[model samples]
Target: MNAFDSVVVEVADIEAAACFYSAVLGSDSPHVCLRASQDPTSGFRGFALSLVVSQPGNADAVIDAAVDAGGRVVKSASKSLWGYGGVVQAPDGTVVKVATSAKKDTVPVSRDVGELVLLLGVEDVKASKEFYAGRGLSVGKSYGSKYVEFAADPGHIKLALYKRRALAKDVGVSEEGTGSHRLVLSGAAGPFRDPDGFVWEASASAPLTATA
Candidate 1:
C-alpha cells in the first residue's frame, strides 16, 4: 500500500500561514505541511482537511482557535446525525473542519486530534477511487458512487473522496474553482498527479521505495 506521509498546502505567504497554522494546529502536527506558493488560485480548492477529535467540546475548541487565528468560519459547530462538526476556511484558502462522532465530552477538552482526514472533492468518486487504486492505495470503505475512503497505514493521513458539488455544499462553499488545487500530498508514492489534478510528490522523510 502507498502510505501517504503528509499534505503540503500551498499558501501565498509562508510567514503568515506559519503563524496561522501554529496558532490553529500548533507545531509539528502530523499530516499537514505548508509550502509557499503564489499560484493564482481562487474559490474552492477541491479539498478539505478534517480534524477528528474525541468529543463535541474538542471540536468547539479547535474551531475557536481557528477563528481566533484569522480563519473564517464557514459553518459554525453544530450537531448532525453523523456527528458534531463545523467548517472553517483557513487563512490560505484551505478548508479546515473539526468533527467528532461522540456527542458529549468524556474527558477534558484539549487540542488533541485523534485523526486528520484529507477529503478531496473530485468530479467522479469511482474514477478517483480507481485512480488512487492504481497508485497502490486500497479502498477502506466505499458508498457506491457517493463516497470512497482509502486505507492508510497507522500514523498516516486518512484519504477520502466526495463529489465536488456535494463537498462544497458540505463545507458551505461554491464548487466552482479555477487555477491551482494548491494542495500536494507527499508520501512513498513519489511524484504523480491524480485524475482530479491533485499533485503527489515524494516525501523526503519517507521516500518511495524502488520495487524489486
Candidate 2:
C-alpha cells in the first residue's frame, strides 16, 4: 500500500523556513551549502529537506503520480529559492517538496522528525475519520468525540480530522468571517494551521541536541 512519506511547506524565505521548521520540529538546523550547477558530476543543488520514504528513487515518480492523480504542480520541480531540490502541490492542493544529493554518501540524513501530521478541516469529523480508516489508516486518538487523529506511520499521527467551527474556536477565532490565519508551531514535533484552512505538523526523527 502507498503510505505517506513527507510534507512540504512553501515559505517566502528558505532560510527562515528551515530555521522555523528545525526549531518547531525539534530537529537540528538544515545543512547549508551551495549547489554546483556547472559541475556535471555535481547534480542540481539547492536547499534540501530530508524525509523518509520507502522508495527513495520513486520520489520524483510519486510526485508525478500525484499530479496525474489530480494534484497540481504549484511549483515545478526545480532548484528552489532556498537552494534545494523541491516539488510543490499535490492533487488536493497540498504542497509536497523533495531534495537530493549527487554524492550518494553525502546525502543529508533525515532525523526521525517524529510523525508528519496533517490537520484536515472537514464538514464532518466522523465521516472523514471513517473514510481514512477504510483507506488503510489506523485511528490513533480522539478528543471529546469532536476531533480525531489517525496514524499512517508509527510515531506519527498522519492526519487530524476536525470540524471547521471547532478549529476556529480552538484558536480563539470567531469564525464569523473568512477563517484566515496562520498558526506556527515550534518544537521537535508540533502542528500548525495555514491560511488556506490546512493544518500541518512536523517532528524530527530524534530529539535535537545542539544548534548551529
Candidate 3:
C-alpha cells in the first residue's frame, strides 16, 4: 500500500536548516541530504531531502534518483561532530536526516513511517472542506460529531477539521505551548493541530508503557 512517508518542510537553504534541526533534536547532522537546482523551467522539480543515514539497502539508488531528478548536492556524504553521521542534500527542497545507527544497519527503526498532517484553523468547516476537496483530497467518514477526517494520502488523512474548544478538551491538553510537545505516534500516524491551536495525534500503536 502507498504509505505515509516523512513530512516535508520548505526551507530557504538545506545546510542551514539541517544545522537547526540537529541542534533542536540533539542529533547528528543528516547523513542523506539534497539541495534543489536553480531551474524554473525544470517543471515540478526544486530542492532536495537528505537522509543522515542510509535507508535499508536502497541508499545509493535513492541518492542517485534524487540527483537525476534535478536535485543538487549541498553537502556530500560525511561524518558529523556527533558519533552518528549523515548526508546533507539532494535536489528537491526537502532536507532529510536519519540517525547513524539506522544507516549502518540499513533498516528503518520504526515499523511504520508517518507524516505530519496539519490541522489548520478555519472559519467555516464546510468552506474548508470544499477548499481541500477541490485540491483532489477525498473527505472520509467523521470521527464522532466533532471531527471530519479528510484523506491525506491513499490510506491516511491530512486535515481533521473540528470544533476548536471540543478538540482541546478531548486531547486533555491546553492550546498554550501546543507546538512544544512532540507527539510520536505509531507507523503512518497522522498528527494535527486544531483550529484553536490545540494539538492532537492519532496512531494505531499500543499504549505507552510507564518507565521507572
Candidate 4:
C-alpha cells in the first residue's frame, strides 16, 4: 500500500527539539524522526502533524504536555461538532494537533496517542490524491477537491491531504510560506518529492524511531 513508515522533522534546535518531542510524544510513537536544519521557512509551512487519542481527556493531556514542553497552543482544546481537539506549535514552528472523536473519557487521562496522521496541505487536493494513488496508496476517505485520506497500514503513520488555505485555518496558521517544508516522509514508495514539494525517503534509510 506504500504506507509511510515514519516522518522526519527538521528542527532548528536539535537538543531542545529532542527533549520537547520526547516529552510530548511519550513512549508510544508513530515513528517520528528529527533532523537538525535551519531551513528558511515562514508562516504555515503547509503541513500539520496530528496525534489522535482515545478520548477528550487524552487529547487534553497531550495538549498540556506539549504546552509544558515549550509549545504554544494555537487552538485551545474544546468540544466541537466533530469532537474535541486543539492545535499547538512547537518552539521550532512545527504545527501539531491533539484530537479525538470521542467526546467523553473512555479511560483515565493519559498520554496515550492512538494514531498519528501527517497532513499535507497542497494547492490541489485532487491532483495530490491522484499522484499518491498512482504510487500505490489506496484512498480511505475523500471529500471531493477538499480532502483525502489514504488507508493506513497497521501501526504505521496515516497520510492525508487537505487544501492549503483550509488546512491553515484548521491548524490556526497563515497559508503563505516559502523555502523548505522542513518535513520528510519515509516509506517504501519514495525517494521522491511529491507534486507539492514534500520529500519522501525510502524506509530503508530511516529507523522506526529516532531523534536528531
Candidate 5:
C-alpha cells in the first residue's frame, strides 16, 4: 500500500518554527524539518497539514497551544463534514488543520497533535492524481475531478489532493503564490515536484511518527 511519510517546511527562522510546531505537536518532532530559505515569504502555502485526534475536544486544546506557540488562528474549532477542526497558520506560514472524527481509538491521549495528514491543493486534480498514481500512491475514496485521497498505513500521514481554489477557501487563503510549497515526502521512488511546485523528497530516514 502507498503511504505518506513526512513533510519539510522552509522557514525564515528555523528555531521559531521548531518551537511553535513542537508545542502544537506536543513533542519536538523529527518529522518537521526546517530549512533556511533565501526567500521566505508568508502566504497561502497551498497545502495544509492535518492533525487527526481521537477526541474532538483535543482539537480545541491544540488550537490553544498553537496560538500560544505563535501560530495564528485562521479558523476557530467547529464541526465540519470531515469532522471537528479549525485552521491555524504556524509561525513559518504552514497551514495546519486540527480535526477529530466520531470514531474512537484506544491510543492514549497526549498533549500533542495526533495522526498528521498532508493535504495538498493542485491546479488539476486529475492530472495530479495521474502523476502520483504513476509514482506508486494508491487511491482511496475520491470525488471525480474534485478530490482524491491516498491510502496510508495506520498513524502515517495520509496524502490528499483537492482543487486549488476550493482548498484555499476551505482553510481561508487566496489560491495564488509562487516558489516552493515547502513540503517533502519521504519513501517515494525519488524526489519529485508536483505541477504546482510542491516538493516531495524521498529519504531513507526513519518515518515520522504522530507523537514523539
Candidate 6:
C-alpha cells in the first residue's frame, strides 16, 4: 500500500521547528530535514499537516500545546461536516490542522492507529489523482471534485488532496502563494510535483532528535 512514510517541512530555524513539533506532537514527530533557502522570499502557504486525535478534547489540547510552543492560530476549532478541526500556523508559517472524528451514524470514523495525514492543495483534483495513480497510489475514498483521500499502509501517514482555493478557505488563508513549499513527503510511489507546486521526494531519514 502506498503511504506518506514521513513529511519534511523546511524551516528557517531547524531546531526551533523541531522543538515546536516535538512539543505539540509528542516525541515521535515528523523527521526534520533542514533546507535553508537562500531566497528569503520563500514562505509556505499551500499545504497542511494534520494531527488526528482519538478524542475531541485531545484536539483542543493539541492546539493549545501548539500555541504554547510558538504557533499561531489560523482558524479556531469547530465542528465541520467531516469532523472537529482547527488550523494553526507554525512559527515559520507552515499550517497545521488538529482534528478528531466526530461520532456519527452516517459517517463514522474508522478505527485506525495512524494519527497523521499530510494534506496538499492542488490546482486540479482530477489531474493530481491521476498523477498519483500513475505512481501506484490509489484513492480509497473521495468527495466529488473537491477532495480525495488515498489508502495508505498501516502505521504510515495518509495522503489527501483538495482544491487549492477550497483548501485555503478551509485553512483560513488566501489562495495566493509563493516560492518553495517548505514541505516534502517521503515514500510516495515516486517523485512528482502536483499541479499546485508541492514537491514529493522518494527518500527516508531518521526522526529529528531533541539534540538535532
Task: Quantify all predictions' global Cα lDDT against the true fold.
Answer: 0.84, 0.40, 0.36, 0.86, 0.75, 0.73
**Model 4 CA deviation exceeding 4 Å by range:** 27-30, 205-212
- Candidate 2: tens digits of C-alpha lDDT, residues 1-212: 22333444333334444433443233442321111111121211111122323233334544455455544544454433433333544221223444343213233444223234455455677766665566555777877448887655544325566676664443233334332222222322235443334433443322322222
Residue-by-residue lDDT tens digits, candidate 6, 1-212: 57667776777776667767876766654544445443343444678877777655667777888898899998998887777878898887788888878633243333222378778888888888888878888789888788999998776778899887888887888878787777767774647776676678886755653322
lDDT string for model 1 (1-212, tens) is: 84988888888867667666776666766566777777899999999998899999889988998888889999989999998999998889999988999978989889888888899999899998998888889999999899999998888889999999988998899998899998888888769988888999987442121111
TM value for model 6: 0.85
Candidate 6 residue spans exceeding 4 A from truth:
30-34, 38-44, 80-82, 103-114, 209-212
Judging by TM-score against the true structure, name the best candidate. Answer: 4
Candidate 1 TM-score over all chains jointly: 0.94
The C-alpha RMSD in Å for every predicted model, in order, reads 4.4, 18.1, 16.3, 1.7, 3.7, 4.2
**Per-model TM-score on C-alpha atoms:** 0.94, 0.38, 0.30, 0.94, 0.86, 0.85
Q: Which residue pairs clash in candidate 5?
A: none
Give the least accurate 10-residue stretch of model 3, judged by summed lDDT: 41-50
| TM-score of model 3 (CA atoms) | 0.30
Clashing pairs in 1: none
What lDDT tens digits, residue by residue, belong to model 4 across residues 1-212?
84688888898887667666887776445477788887788888889998899999888888888888899999999999999999999888889998998989977789888898999999999999999999999999999999999999887888999999999999888888889899989998898999999999988444324454
Better of 1 and 5 by lDDT: 1
- Cand. 2 TM to true fold: 0.38
- Candidates ranked by TM-score: 4, 1, 5, 6, 2, 3
At residue 8, candidate 3 shows an lDDT of 34
lDDT of 2: 0.40
CA lDDT, candidate 6, residue 171: 81
